[model samples]
Target: MRAYADFVVEYKLTVEFPNFQDKIYVRDGEELARWWIAQTNRPDTIFCANDEAAAGFITEIRRAKFSVLGDIAIIGFDNTEVANLLDFTTIHYPVDQQAENAFLILQNMLHSTDKTLIPLEYTLIERHTT
Candidate 1:
């Protein structure tokens, strides 16, 4: 949310954060699809917190006779197996790198007390869903 807020501020874009007051999961995303269709002016794109939610959103939209990346676009995070299977755009989270960093941190901890924190980074894996 903070990252999105920063992006909106930096670009001076008017974006609305609708309070669905529910966890951002597959069910929520499905519900969101219904809400989206009810809107007179629908958003051009949606940024889901995870691929599962995005997949659910895609399924629901397609069921409603809406075309992917045609009626709306979607971007999801945590490029999971579903993301690849669904061919949706997502952020490739560096799980392997994070595990390696953890190991290095532990090895260093045994020798010294210096605590180090690696920066969080992600790669955008573009796919047709975007």
Candidate 2:
């Protein structure tokens, strides 16, 4: 949240969200959409925690007569299959690479005493949604 706030401040962009403890889920999207609808100055875009939330949010947004990447844009993390099906923009987490690196790290640790950090890569998949 601090990073998002910092980005918003740096770019002078407005943001809004409901005060929810757990913001993960396909169901939480409806809750977020309801919050957006209630706002007088509704946001033009939303950054969801994951594809499931984005999917859920879009479901409600469409039900409320809003269009994805038209009336509003959406971006999510994890690059899930749901994101592909929805054609939503998302940040793809390198899960496979991370797991492979972890396995190698553990194997090396068995012989070496030194602990080191492994770097992995991530990418943005720009789809229909921004």
Candidate 3:
């Protein structure tokens, strides 16, 4: 998640994570939202690790009387179908392509085939949020 923090910094945006004062962890969605709102000073953009976290954040934000993608832009990773249905902007990791590449590699290793294999590709799928 440090890398994600660095990404926000590079983009000239502020980020905040839930406090972790101990080894054991918790996922209190409301607490996380409060911390994030306080730390970012209610910034107009938020980035979450996954769609689930983003969904939680959005719920809290809505409960706080804030409009999603209107007052703030929310983005999550892993282009899940739910994210698409929710019109979320996400990182579209090529999972199918990756599996294909892995299968090709394993097949080549298991059998001496002279067939050429194509590499996997990835692209960002833009949506409602920026």
Candidate 4:
């Protein structure tokens, strides 16, 4: 999560919009709302660390009279059930593939003594929340 945030900063997303950092971090939706209320310039796009936070953010923003996806575009990691229910855009973690890889590594270890690296894949599911 920190790496992604660093990437956003390294690529100049934060430089382009300084408010990105503040709007992206909060204890919960209520705190997010408080931050939004205090912001002179509210960010239209937010990238949450997880779907739970994204869902909370969406609920709070709507409560504050902002349209979800229309007024704010939110992206979250971990494409959980809540994210699907809310039709939010999120990064899908391939847990099955990861488990398979781990199993294979154990099998290999039992048969032979060798070190191998396995790569995991992730997908971005685009939905109404963008």
> Which candidate comes out best when scored by TM-score?
2
Candidate 1: worst 10 consecutive residues by lDDT?
Answer: 15-24
lDDT tens digits by residue: candidate 4, 9-122:
788774333333433333565466557656878877878878777887888887789887777798888888988998989999887878888887888889885656467778
- Candidate 2, lDDT over the whole model: 0.85
| Alpha-carbon runs more than 4 Å astray in model 3 | 1-31, 101-119
Q: Clashing residue pairs, candidate 3? A: none
Error of 2 at 62 (Å): 0.6
Q: Candidate 4 clashing pairs?
A: none
Q: Write one digit per residue (lDDT tens) for candidate 3, span 31-102.
A: 556666666456678666666666666678778887787788877667887678777787777777777778
lDDT of 2 by residue, 24-105 (tens): 8988977888888788887798988888999999999999898888889899889999999989999998888788778878
lDDT of 3: 0.67
Total backbone collisions for each predicted model: 0, 0, 0, 0
Cand. 4 TM to true fold: 0.67
* Alpha-carbon lDDT, every model: 0.84, 0.85, 0.67, 0.75
Q: Please tell me which model should have the higher lDDT, number 2 or number 3.
A: 2
Against the true structure, what is each candidate's TM-score? Answer: 0.75, 0.78, 0.59, 0.67
Each prediction's RMSD to truth: 3.4, 3.2, 5.5, 4.8
List the candidates ranked by lDDT, beginning with the highest.
Answer: 2, 1, 4, 3
